[model samples]
Target: MALLVLVLSAIPRPAHAEIAAWMVFEVGSGEVIDQHEAFRRWYPASLTKLMTAYVAFSAIKQGRITLKSPVMVSAHAAAQPPSKMGLKAGSTLSLDAALKVMLVKSANDISVAVAETIGGSQAGFADVMNKTARELGMRDTHFVNPHGLPASNHYSSVHDMALLSRALLRDFPQYKRLYGYTGVQYGKRLLRSANREYLRRVRGANGLKTGYVCNSGYNVAVSATRGGRTMVAIVFGAASGLERAAKASALIEKGFDGGGVFKSHPKLDNLKRPGSVKGLPPDGYCRRNAKPKLEKLMADYAGSAPMRAANSGLPGVRTAFARESGRTRAAGIATSRADTTIPRTRDKKVDWGVVMDRLIGAQRRSDNLVRITLAIDPNAKRAVPLSAPSADDASKNVADAFGIVMPPRGKPDSRPATQPADTNTNAVPVIVTVPTRASDGTPTPRPAPR
Candidate 1:
């Protein structure tokens, strides 16, 4: 018993499930390659901008707007928190420039500017977004804002994001260049892409987006093509940007290695959501106190010194790798003996501290801005009415306008049932455990019955 206990203690185990939800699917066939907790709703962060872009694309396709259309910033848009272009109210950029800045810089201001230009108001744009989500069969997603600044009731699943990514590639292949940009040049400043690191490190990586907020840890939607095979990987709630990139890289490699049209595996559209999976709450894993353990976990899982060495020169990344590599060596975990040569870059150095400070400060700034806006701007408060009529209510209203009597809500019909309940004794019974909700609204996982 002592010997068995000692062996078990020596075995490795993950400290935490750092990635809350993920999915990898083949673009050509829509075949699901691999997925984990794919259906559980989680914060979309800036990935919400993808949908915002999609709606804009649809409007352009319908001749309601054009790429050359001018998008002007408003006080409301300029008031948006950071990760922005810092454009002042009344400043205008062409729709094309707006898309480039929004996707590359993940600009909150540009997102709202585009929303206002195309949809008239932020709330109006949100209605269009929700409609587009339904049209695309993204049942688990709801968008309350365009820029994905933290908001209650805004959520998406990896499954839905993968679908959105695939849709963008399929519908607007011409815009593929937008996602792959390293940086976009505005009048005086060249704004770098948030996804530049992934594009540089991952082979065949091209387009997509990255997002972060206190509620949602680092999130990325990456699409890559190799040997004529394209794969899309969506990861939500990773502990850090580095870990998010590494996990995405791993999943993409796995997909290319073992993924294809598996006849038994369901297509992306047909893949069912796991009934009992619960959405993850914010873990605040990016906080200073949590870095050591998470960094060590990243080093162990990465298993490649070259990978770490190659990225060591990135702004704010070298220190993390330095500490993590030391611990990795002390633990005697063998890493690949491949080349440790650090790649050189001629691009200007980035001050990662300022970037991270802006991101971290956004939540507080946004909260304050919201309170101030609501107090001073009565129009903003009226923009999104809390008691606005739903689709069902609208339908009933239409019926009443035509003097038609609609059935009362939840009233059982007097008519006989058309179909009988299934009574087959030989059928296998599948049990699903429903997760309960905590007082804070986070889903609490329940144990399954035997």
Candidate 2:
């Protein structure tokens, strides 16, 4: 970034380079400090889920669905794409589980399953998505597909992305923690987050999805909060993943450059509550349908502890660097990354083949379904160090695997299989732990399985 900053500063005048698009703003207040080609059109890739989740949250609030609402997978929905929850057509997820799947993996099929279950089909839910966007002042955005896979007419501007971020904070503040999912596990399988920063050691950084498509380059919408102050930043189309994070850090610093909203509220403690847990809701269809006991408390904090005491400091948003020895100073920040010098080439065009390897917690051929709740200590990163469940009592292991119980009693269609199961725990590991940033400050690129 210092080199880029120096390069930008050295530019005698603004050059017409396709620099990445980005912006940063205070959530509650509509303050835009730094901006580039924020209005430029770009492909959202998976970031489209932010809108989908927003509408789902709205439905939950409206009593149309519950966290426990059951959404059954349909053959059509199951056929969509990988990055899926891999449930069969007959399987059902509580509304909550469905949300989790979508939030966590940016699963495409689960998005459709939730849409169909809630609105009766994809077209119906899309109506809600577009209308909601209009109301949120996302004038330059449109949703053609529930999952943000390629669609002919789908497009959005970075400016619009910032607008959606603002709405998420203002309207659905209760579910903000949903944005912070680094990785999650279901029973034995490990599902990692695609957001590298969260998987790494960056603190205060929660989430907003990361995305890429050949035409879109790379896009990431990230929000980080410390104390009571929260800032939302968006970076679209970057040359490299490391560059994206660095650029985002700059935008965020610029946003904090002016002043914070919590300046007057000295006692306001910052709290990030349990947001919609990913995978579970969107795939499991077990989101809150009816407000439960202690709903207010649940509303206040979704999952994590709150932060108290605020820090007062400003981080500058620097783009092109200015050499101390040189007389040059960066004029306006450089906008696109499509400079002639930095070649625009992808390592390999993404081949969306066998995208569902992680689905079914590792695909297995059997009529029986295994459920397990593998307790994970957040501080404990390695796989659960426990005696083998299978080597012990088979029935108890089955019970533990499916700890919550099968179709138990809720839905008449819910049926548990008497068929015997494989004893292997068959651990399917998908979550990729991004190496913590070395103190020397160099990014070690760990390729996330596409």
Give per-residue CA lDDT, model 2, range 139-224, as digits (tens): 66888877777765787877778878777877888887666666556666756556644323233566777775545556788876
Strongest candidate by lDDT: 1
Task: List where candidate 2 sits over 4 angstroms from the true fold.
Answer: 1-18, 259-450
Candidate maximizing TM-score: 1
- Count of clashes, each model: 0, 63
Displacement of the residue 374 alpha carbon in candidate 2, Å = 13
Badly placed stretches (over 4 Å) of model 1 are 1-17, 259-264, 280-289, 292-299, 303-450
